[model samples]
Target chain A: MSKQYLTTHTVDEAHPTEIFSVSPTPSSLFSASGSSALQIHSTTKGGFPLQQTITNAHRLGCHHVCTSRGGVGNVAASVGFGGEIKIWARQGSELLPQHEANGEWELRWEIAPTQTNGGDVWAVALSADESYLACTTSDGRIHVWDLTARERIQSYETGGSGTGGSFAMAVDLSRDGKLTATGHESGAVYVFNNNSGRLAYSLSGLAKSVRAVAFSPGCKRLAAAGDAGVIAIYDMERGEHVSNLSATSSRPAWITSLDWNDTGEYLLSGALDGKVKVWDVARGVCVATHSETEGALWSVRWLPKNERALEPGMGKGEMFCAAGANKSLTFYREATGI
Target chain B: MVRFPGQTVQETRKFEALFCILELAHEALLSGNLITLRNIYYQNMELFVSQAVVNVMIDSLASTLGVGRWDLNIGILLPSINSIEKIDFHSVKWVLVIEKEATFRTLAASQYHQTSKAGHGILITDANRLPLSQGARARLNSGSQRDRPTKRSRTDRGGDPVASITNKPFLQKAENRGVTSLQQSISTEYPEANHLGHEQRLEEELVHGVNENAISHHGAGDPVNSTMTLTQTDRKKVVSILNEICTGEGTVCTAVSMEQKQELQRMLVLNIKAEIQAVDHFGDITKWLDEKLCKW
Candidate 1:
């Protein structure tokens, strides 16, 4: 019940501008910021040393950078504020842009929103194997693109396309690659079947804007949080609202980001009040709260567990990193009394 | 006289009934569930004569526990909206007011806030035809008077001057100027490339490599520098070279030898990085080109 997470490291100046998103590869962390530079920091080292900086990676500045998890072959996809998507292939700690023989980086494919299209692409997610990419547009349309073929294979619409269509704020692809879930400004969470390309369930409960949606490790449950100030958990198998997770505080705070541990036992949330809370899902109670700053946290991610922790005698532990308006990446690990 | 000087039969019966109700309510609260006062009254109609008696017992129990009746997980039957007046709305962003019972039911059934565009607004309805509770009215008034903006700025927009300079033409001009200045500085610092013989020898070496099909198979088809089209056989040869480099294997004479495989991998990675940078640079320009073509 005490503070479960201890501040491990703080990169004071990770970005010259506000860092919007941070994606971790097996050995490195790639952060995209308001500046055009996409920086790679080595996670294997103690201080998370700056390994490389891809300058001018996004002319208009990058907003989101994501890497496929579950040993997904070191491929990453980044979305820039300029409405362009760039895919990078990792080789020896370097993320190189995919290109052709002409000494020019190839524009593998694009998801462009024209004046007549009535939608602007906002969020993107890649499959575990890096074979498929899913993105959400402003008009509540989710497009799944086949990376190998470089084409839009399927498009799922949430209806009300005209002025009524809500902006798709966040998206996540299931680890098994069978499902894609999206959260919208309309406070609706929709899950789609990747094979049939039909909506699996239209989840309801949270009425405020849903900023973040994530699938649990086993893919049996989905967690969503946003302006509603409470995290909503849905049973993925039955497509039913299971329970609502609320903080002990009577006053509500907008939740900006959510992440689940490897075992999915604890759900972590970062909110506008700069407080990061760990929720015990089974008990439906918040066990701990840590507030290090007052700046709103934009992104939080759980680092992949290392092999040493998997040893027989070692106790299970978890670590995560958070970044936002503070312009610094703070790493937190479970307090083990070391 | 045997019991006590102040304890009469009526007072003893009332105390017993209050104790029983408190015990039942405490059990319900301990189970982490809610119980209605009507249900408690029905459970022991003989002990408590009426629903009003059960409500009074619950209030007494709440006072004894030093908590509110709601905190004890007790709810009244058909509770009026006025009871929720004290519900906190300080952290809420917006409030939705509904006047019709049917409309409120429909909205509640569908979880209207999920589908409503209003972000994180509290939904309030006068379904019971009751007046607004004092607490609810105070919250509404204070919420409206508060000057806080509903949406938070996402990425430090006004803080950075460079981020505000989003004009494409101006950025392109600045980039060109920087490139020219860099070139001038390099030329002044290192004059070896300016020598006539060295420049000519480098060009001859590049031509010789192209003639031998060492680098031309891939470089000759560059859309930016070359107008020459590649034949099917040449294209096949180039694809084979790429496959060999990617797979780190070779079978025929066209394959990269073992000694050069590492060099080929390094070059491929560097080219990929450059190409990625180029794509970011031209991403917007390419979209403009597509728009122009579509217009035509």
Candidate 2:
């Protein structure tokens, strides 16, 4: 049976321009767009209020924003259209005496755009401990950096060899910190073993350009989606191809983002057609599908449920958020009575 | 004696915020009144700066105190009801306790109480008073007692900042709170008192804090916790507040530098607008509530 969901709240025109990316920590959602500033919406509050904003985060505007997937939520990294990656640290919102400084989300460091560091970093992911950072380049190379030392510790070549590999579109660090996975424009999804500094898996599933790759919370499964409009689940331990998640729609849209829930029981995906789907991992079914806008959806994420303040009759349920070309952020809550 | 000892600039501010929040929380716990984070934010806008600041502090304090969030008497505020005395439950038949604040707000705002049984009161309660979550209850089960350094020893060494307030006899405060008007019971005096409880006069240190935190710890086997984690620690525990209070050396950060207030203000330019809006809206919200709710 399909699980019923209700669109709880929508923040209209959250950004003046199309939102390009959205990521969530346990209590906050970081949203970035073609705007100079980055906005953070409080997921646990009413209407998901814009709790913080990092002004002039990117002079050229930002395209991607990602928070540490591990539970602590102490670190966040963002990519500007200028190809610069800025790292942010979550500090308790301190009362500062200035007209300008108002954010708890403070920028800690910046990696200036350069041909070095494996090519201009296109996508970035922070390890669970926030000690290591992994970034992908347009030349299909992935570089891992020890954040504390500010040094590139290892680099993996996707066979670009000074030319023609594929544009690395997405990257994610497994919560266990053992694996770093990336999706490339050549329809290639690669998993690198961080401990051994070797290529762990190169899977062929989506025949189209791969846009997103995410390691399940437990690190048991990896889900990837892109132009092929199909989500492929791969076994992380064995590097074997698993079941493909296909929608009943005749012309499926390119999936832009994928996130496995905290329990790994459910997967949340958003496509270019502005559709968000929740898939049950075990039963292999699209449990809930939502079409909030006809405009393209660039990103989607599952907001970590507020463990505190659960009222009576509020059976266990989930909450997820989506934002994109519509310039607004939409949040949906699982219909508990269902 | 001003040894913050190896703490970075950001940590110093975090501790400042922590101490500010704890002093207010200590007062709320003693006065026998519960306040939400939003409630705390409105009390001191200059200090908290924004609702988000208060939000961040609440989470950090709950994790640091090793106490329930409600144990801090901090929760989400309800905008529906201004007072309980105005609520006439005499004509009510069905008392509905709904889940989800949005639904509860909609139910209360839509005249659901009037339509229930065709003109009888439906006594909708403060949803914030809902039963504690499972994790919160397990934390309240009165974990085994272990001997620790005495507060007299710690305070004599001029180490513990919270020693003064949490040392008072908790029962006397509760009995004192019993005779006060309901408004006084729910109103807190901490934030307005000072940044820290030590600054408050000894004569005014009327309520016990951490012991009440412990009293509520043993309240699980009883249904007292059904009243939203409202339990007083054993009077002895209150008198010995620091004994089991600071667990895990208290809220250690893995390694992130904190920014100074001026630097934070500059970095958070976008948030300043929210702070302004919250200030302007505070009076309007109070006036709106007086017009919309108290009349009911």
RMSD of each: 30.6, 26.3
Where's the lowest-lDDT run of ten residues in candidate 1 chain B?
A: B145-154
> Once superposed on the true structure, which residue ranges of model 1 sit more than 4 Å away at CA?
A1-3, A92-118, A161-164, A308-316, B1-296
Error of 1 at A295 (Å): 0.6
lDDT digits (tens) for residues A65-177 of candidate 1: 88775543356778765556787765532343331111212234445544115455567888887778888775678888888787889988887544435667789998888
**What's the TM-score of chain B for every model shown?**
0.27, 0.28
Tens-digit lDDT track for model 2 on A226-283?
Answer: 7678899999999988999989865677788899988899999987677899999888
> Which residue pairs in candidate 1 have backbone atoms (N, alpha carbon, C) closer than 3 angstroms, thus clashing?
A105-B275, A208-B120
In model 2, state the lDDT of residue A195. Answer: 90
Error of 1 at B232 (Å): 47
DockQ of each: 0.01, 0.01
